[model samples]
Target: MATTKLTLSVDPEVIAKARRISKLRKTSVSAMFSRYIATLEESKQRETPLPPMTKRALALAAGTAPVPENWDYRDELKDILDERYGLK
Candidate 1:
């Protein structure tokens, strides 16, 4: 396929990172950005929509548990409900 040179105004830090990644992957920065653009286009053309807000909400709620491994989740949930309802 015929390719064109597209000029972009990007931060020097971003250019450094891209150069580093290109070196690690054994490819040119242009090729790396080309693959990225192709992947982005493929995702944009997909039939399925992205996950909704509810899924994001559930993920945020389910982040690594803050409780101890031996803790009883049900007991804590019950206690929370009781406290919420003013039930001693």
Candidate 2:
């Protein structure tokens, strides 16, 4: 696959943080942005919708929420309830 040069206009602070994180992760800022975009693409392809609370919780989140293929509603509900009620 061929890679292309893409330009983005982000806040300087965000770019600085990305650079710091990329260095720590031993990857380039371009790679980090590419992975982030790829993740957004993948989540966009999922059919499942994000639960209401999760949606609310991630109201500030960018792009679509990802739901795994093996995502279990009942188990997730149980876990959320258990954590909420301290019944775990």
Q: Which ten residues in a row have the lowest lDDT in candidate 2?
A: 57-66
Cα lDDT tens digits, model 1, 43-87, are: 888858557897787788897767778899899999999999999
Candidate models: Cα lDDT each: 0.91, 0.91
**Least lDDT summed over 10 consecutive residues: which range in candidate 1?**
47-56
lDDT tens digits by residue: candidate 2, 5-82? 988899999999999999999999989998999999998898698899899878766566788899999999999999
lDDT for model 1 comes to 0.91
> What TM-score does each of the candidates earn?
0.54, 0.52
RMSD of each: 8.6, 13.6
After superposing candidate 1, which stretches have Cα over 4 Å from the reference? 49-88
- Misplaced by over 4 Å in model 2 are 49-88
User: With candidate 1 superimposed using the best TM-score fit, by how many Å does residue 57's alpha carbon deviate from the native?
Assistant: 17
- Give the lDDT of residue 77 in candidate 1: 97
Angstrom error of the Cα, residue 87, model 1: value is 9.6
